[model samples]
Target: MVSFGIWGLIPPVLTITLAFITKDVMVSLFLGILSGTLIVAGGNPIIAILNLTDMLAGSLNDGWNIRIFLFCALLGGLVGMLSKTGSARAFGRWAADKLNSPKTSLLMAWFCGLVIFIDDYFNSLAVGTVMRPITDKNNVPRAQLAYILDSTAAPVCILVPISSWVITVMSIVKGSEGFSSLGISEFEFFMRSVPFNIYAILTLIMVLTLILTGRNFGPMAKSIKYAKETGKLYNEDYGPAPGEIEVEGEQNSSKARPMDMLFPILVLIASAVILFPMTTYLGAIDGESITSLGAAMGSMSLGDAFNNTDASMALFYAVIFTLLITYIYYTVRKLFTIKSASDAIGDGIKSMVPALIILTMAWTIGSVIKSSPEDGGLGLAAYLSEVVVGGGFPIALIPVIAFALSALISFSTGTSWGTFAIMIPIVMPIVVGLAQAKGLMDGAMLNSVLISISAVLGGSVFGDHASPISDTTILSSTGAGCPHLEHVATQMPYAITCAVCAFIGFLIGGIFLNLFVAWLAALGAFVLALVFLPRIYKA
Candidate 1:
């Protein structure tokens, strides 16, 4: 990879700065991409303009990107159908009677978030779509809902050993030549690293504590207080929220029931979980013996199926089918006319237009950062890797170094998977080289390797969990009907809190090589935050 020296840092930095300052992500992303292209084009203005359009177009050309775009839009359409039919309102009433309080409502949303942990995209969209009305009835702010959805999505998925995140992570580690020499299976290594993933574990704890204790702090607290005083779920001061454009028909029907809102969503969740694994399983299965679904199921364990699953493709298929089911389900129940249902679906797709545009620009900039150096791309990940690893840090500080660099790279590129691709290769060599050079083949060495690898994974998630340009971050706000910037702003304090604790944990782990002790120390700081933050920064 070609190096751009310090110049590679310009695009994401410019984009992030502009976003906070201007409160306009589209303009920020466009200018960010344009800056990178200009640098890549070596000051040729005309060439940079041409390159810009090409890269933007090129982002959608990738199959996974297009699939995810479609899935989000279709999911929006499904949510629209629920809203149009009065099912959402009915469900809200039902929930308000049962849940009764803000704590219960938020906890239910958090629980729903944890349940749909197959993919972060699915988790955020599905949980937000289903739980927003419930939370709204309890007067819980949309910003709070978005924060829960965002906190749960990536953190839960990354921590789960069977999630889509696991597939990407395991593939990276399995491909490392040094890993094979360690004589442990990829799954075994992943399981060992799980305890060391302090950020994901601790963030979930923060969410739970916040929900239970009503510990609102920073911008999130202000949003909560504003909602309580004004009776407005959304604060208009920020600007128009995306995912609020869906057309609605006033439901005059008395037949609307909670199941009207729920059955279709249930099918969607069930179908995604069942369909994705089968799709992944059947696609990867080989030989005549695995000719049928039963045969395939018999062939591999459930974990194997998930490991092979393609979350984007499966979600797109699941949403298309779920849309069909919901359309028919709503019409037959007399909640909507055929024409009304069709219009709702169309309007739902319309609602997602802003999110799509932001996603497009985000992907384009990511491409500009990832593209070959010769092709006017910065090779930003490669550049960052070279610059960071070239410094000779001590072995005892490896976990801290791994975490900080991984977070930086992931935040810069807005992709944890991209960070893993860059960092894992660099990180693996360090641990493996140490093992071989010292000829140490003991549990201490194994614990060191596991903690270092876990640090990289945890650090990567820190960026994905909070970065403004991250796709999951964008989707969380869209899903919850909160303005995107509000989601980013409110989430920053909590994300930073967890990230700091995670860094401290890794520093302890690196020095002592004890995962349990390091985690406890991190937990101790987190406990202090829980006790003091609400008192210090009251809503």
Candidate 2:
């Protein structure tokens, strides 16, 4: 059964454990995919091989992922160039000389991760790569750096209005005939619903607090302790050290010009802003409603509507433009040689090998699940939700449980979009039905506005942020070059802390406040988490 694939947790977990235990992530992941293929194909090795081949092909053929990988590759190239060109080092040196404090550098790193809300995958890759060395230079562990990037990735997107996610979610909601039968404008309802999104708000607060206060917990806390004790984190036992980047050359003595750092970064942000929404509009349909801001064009090309060709093209064009501009800038300024550019691209592609393999495996497993029995998926998900929220538990507690369940499902399945695509449609209708039954429609009574809002937010984002198969999660681990489970393990404690506070806030909102007051209280709770928790982290 598709939903029964919650057991799907076993594959990735085992694979990650194999990597951790044997100290070889690539082999472990490949073997894990083989194991999953066996399970899904009923142990017939012949069918398993056939399915595996198809699954791998589908992953490679998917235009969306190609765009993502290309973005990552380009980001890698950009980071490589920046480092070789002496840009990143110059900026780091300047920051060290001026900003000076670990707290300020960490805070700046956190802020950069938080504000890049165009797309979570892009945010995770770009921020993690750019900030890792900077954070490392300040003695921050890669684990801590990974956590900051992971924390900001999905949470920030949920809170923003014009993100890639917003465009997609709006399209889904607007198109769902089931939702339109309720006579509410989707965008307006979504906006109204945003404030009570406790997970997003709280996660953001937790990240900021962690950055400012430097606390680490769970595997993260352990990783930080290990790094402090042994002077390494992530691949410390095997990977290159900070000072080992270059040896026995004048290059080691050369410092980068500051403009080298600022220019590529500025180009990246500007290009993303100009290009992301442009693609969405380019993908819009003639009769479909479009809500995001970037495109002034009212109609999309035919190629945009039914084909991956258009969407992928838009992403490629955007990335190519950014890369070209970056290349031209370096050329004009005499900061890069053509040989160096070639080397940067080569290094970037080399770095992507592991990520490409992991992604291929993840997609295979997803395809495997989708091919399972239909009743299995919807039934199991519904059952899971009911078990968590359907008990005699107080209505106020439902949202907390919902968040937990969604987080678990997402973390296990490794696909937030899939989790959200399945969960929100189901949960939203239930929440609305409950609100109407309780006479809480439009603040008509003090029934469960807080409860309803929290359910949707927690359900949607829990999966988005934590799912091992999640694009954001995969991207974060790949970007940070930390082991995948290492990323999940380190992030769990922080995510749980925010979830707990959100639950408490939900209780207060449901029991004691009006809808408006309830949302304000939740927002206040988010700020409170930022303040109190920062003091507790030992990072």
Candidate 3:
């Protein structure tokens, strides 16, 4: 193993710093990969370039990565079909009647986000598209819409039980030596850890608090004021794309009904929920003859059943099924001709190309960090864990430290999945080592483990929400037709406010080992912050 010692941190740090400075995610990621590869190649430029290519190729070739990429493309196509059918517009009109005020409109967007808890990417794009027209009509700023879309995307997914986020987390935790040796199932751990995910829970709560209080602060407040006073939804620097306006106008011209949009989404959700459990049960009974479905389900806990299920495969099947159903529904309703529907599908996939590219690069950088030293990978997790352990860092402070590190990493990288991939493996081992050293498992030590895991997830979401380079952040801006930098600026204060509360929650939870008490304190802190901070913006 070619250990880089503490030097392994330089690449990611450089990548993050440059991203903020240049405001170019692609270049930031590329240069970060190059820096890491150069260090691995002993400063040889040619080998470093070759290594970067190999790293990206390996990431693309991985089965899980390929599945997620395909899912994104297919989901995009489905959304495209929704747009082509005028379903989005119909839904917006229907929603406008029910949600008359700006506050209610924002809440409806947040509620839609909560309802579509399957995937964050889907959540960001779909909610933004459907809610943008309504919010704009209600005089809500595009930046505010972007903020609502972003806050609900990953934060909601991470908190929910049956989402892509949970599946990925369970899969990673299952593979960790700590959980495996302890005979603790990843699903069980995930369920137990949800409550301790203070950042995510608090973020969600903060969204509602802002909406209910009819409060907008920081840059968001100024943007909303401009929209209200001038009737311009976007800032001077940014407006809706030509394509977006054209689509909106086309949707207005079409005769599609609200069910046109609502039915397809309902079908998609039902199919996923039904198929996921059924497939999980089937996988659990592989090579065994279970005479009845009920018997098979009874044999395993829901967690175990889901644990054994191929989540990627389940989502793939669900998307394919949903697409077929959507096509049939539209054809039956005479909403569009076959040619138009097909064109929409193709266009939708094209729109997702940028997101897919960014995801691929994010995965590549994560792979580069985690790859073995023999493969010229930095093995960053192992190195960081070593540094933390050896540097006299206290074990009791792991949750808070992990929160800060994960936030920084995710903010820099703009990908929470990448942060989770790099952090979980590193943090679990450290937790195990600390637990063993303390000769504790069931009490405070176990709580620490749970809190630390939650901290990583919570912090990653917080960072992703705040970062301009994040895919969800970009998509949110696109969805709301807001300038990217404006979305980033307006949302940062809100995100930071929640994150501060979460940090305190983690600190209290770690010190006192009382999840309930810590959560209450954190919630109170958030409420107090919300009440006081808006007054500053008001002045």
Candidate 4:
């Protein structure tokens, strides 16, 4: 067994640098994995290449990983079916008829983002599609619409425990050595961390304040004034907004109903909710016969069942069943033939390929970083924790540090999930070590851990919101028919404002180790910005 020591940091640093430079995460991650395998392969390039392929294969070798992959692909297929069947456009038309004001149109977009919390990909694209027409009619700037979509997409997904983001994050956390040290289930830890996710909470608050109060700051203010006064949705200086490239030719566009979209999503959510407890109950039974659903459920509390649930499996099963029913539902409505439905589903799977590749790379790198030295890998978590603890690193400041660093990485890399993949594995062990060194109470240590974890989650969102190359950012712009750069520029002010508020919150929370006070302070700071920043900026 060989210790990599500081050398272990090379792969992540190289990955982050390359991602920032290339603005291409796939290539960046591949290179990063290749580098790590090189370290493990005794600096042999040929063997490193071999190890890289093996690592990628091994990432998908796990039951949990494959189920998550299938869930994501199936969910994508469901989204595709909705698009192919003109369900999204139908919902857009449905909302268009009732929304006469810009604020209301924007509010509807936010509402859609909230409801479509199953996946951020679906949220940004679907909400944008659903609200674009109404917002344009009401003279809302395309940039503003894009901002709202971007805000709601990832932030909302990260906050909700049932979403793909939660499953993915939990999957990553479940594998880390530090998670084992926490003495709680991954789901329970995630649930406890929610209120401490200050940036996401503040971002949503900022969006609502901007919409409800019709206040604006920085580039957004100018964008709003220009678009509303000129009846232009986007800047003419930037040329026509890019094509949305609708998935299918809305053949029955007029005949399509909003329920075509709504019912399937509802079924998916309902199925997952019900299955979570049942599956946990059944898993606990483990070969015992359960004759009655009521008796079995009554045996265990609902919250405990959720805590024990295999979230990835539950979501995968739920989406699988939802896809089957959705196919039959759409076909019966004459939205598409069996063959066309097949094609749409295939395309949807293809759409998820980029994300899947990122996930695969993320998982592979994470495994290498945490694998024991005897396993031909660097024990990064153990090594880094030792270094931080012994080096007199500020024990309480990790939450703030994690938040800022996660933001920088995510902003540079243009992917929050990727940042989570990179940072959480590293941050968790260091925070745990620091907490131990301080001789803190178990409850105090837990609060610190949750705050630190939430910092990583929230900070990644800040970077994602501001990054020009982010998938959600690009999708939000496309959905709203806004120029991508214009959207990024206009969204920067809001992202930064919320980030500052989140930073302050984490600062206080980190110093005092209090989730309650931190969140209240964070919210109050955002509220102040919402109240005074607009007046000051405009004046």
Please tell me which predicted candidate would have the highest TM-score against the true structure: 4
Top-down lDDT ranking: 4, 3, 1, 2
| Clashing residue pairs in candidate 3 (N, C-alpha, C atoms within 3 angstroms) | none
* lDDT by residue for model 1 (1-539), tens: 47576787888678656755665567777998899999988889899999999998887787777876677677667766765776544554566678877899899888877866656765676567667877887898999999999999989988765344664576557544357667666656786788889999898989998888777798999999899899998888887787653223455335677677568768887787787677767775566756677788887788777655666667678888888887777777888887878887787778667656766675677667655687668867556545444554456788999899888766765667656655665577567666555555668778878888999999989988999888899989988999888899899999999999999999998888898889888998888887888789676
TM per model? Answer: 0.66, 0.56, 0.81, 0.95
Which pairs of residues have clashing backbones in candidate 4? none
Give the C-alpha lDDT of model 2. Answer: 0.57
Model 3, runs deviating above 4 Å: 1-4, 7-14, 17-55, 60-63, 117-146, 160-192, 215-253, 286-295, 361-368, 371-380, 390-392, 412-426, 442-446, 468-490, 534-537
Global lDDT of each model?
Answer: 0.76, 0.57, 0.76, 0.84
- Give per-residue CA lDDT, model 2, range 27-141, as digits (tens): 5555655666766666798977776676677665765556554654565565555545655445445555655555776687677676566557656765665566666666666
Task: Look at candidate 1 and tell me the lDDT of residue 334.
Answer: 85
Off by over 4 Å in 1: 4-6, 99-204, 210-249, 285-299, 374-376, 393-503, 506-518, 531-539
Candidate 2 least-lDDT 10 residues = 241-250
Angstrom error of the Cα, residue 231, model 3: value is 7.4
Give the TM-score (vs. native) of candidate 1: 0.66
Where does candidate 2 clash, by residue pair?
Answer: 3-377, 5-8, 215-537, 410-467, 411-467, 414-468, 414-469, 414-470, 415-469, 415-470
Instruction: Mark the regions of model 4 whose C-alpha exceeds 4 Å error after superposition.
Output: 287-299
Q: Specify the highest-lDDT model's number.
A: 4
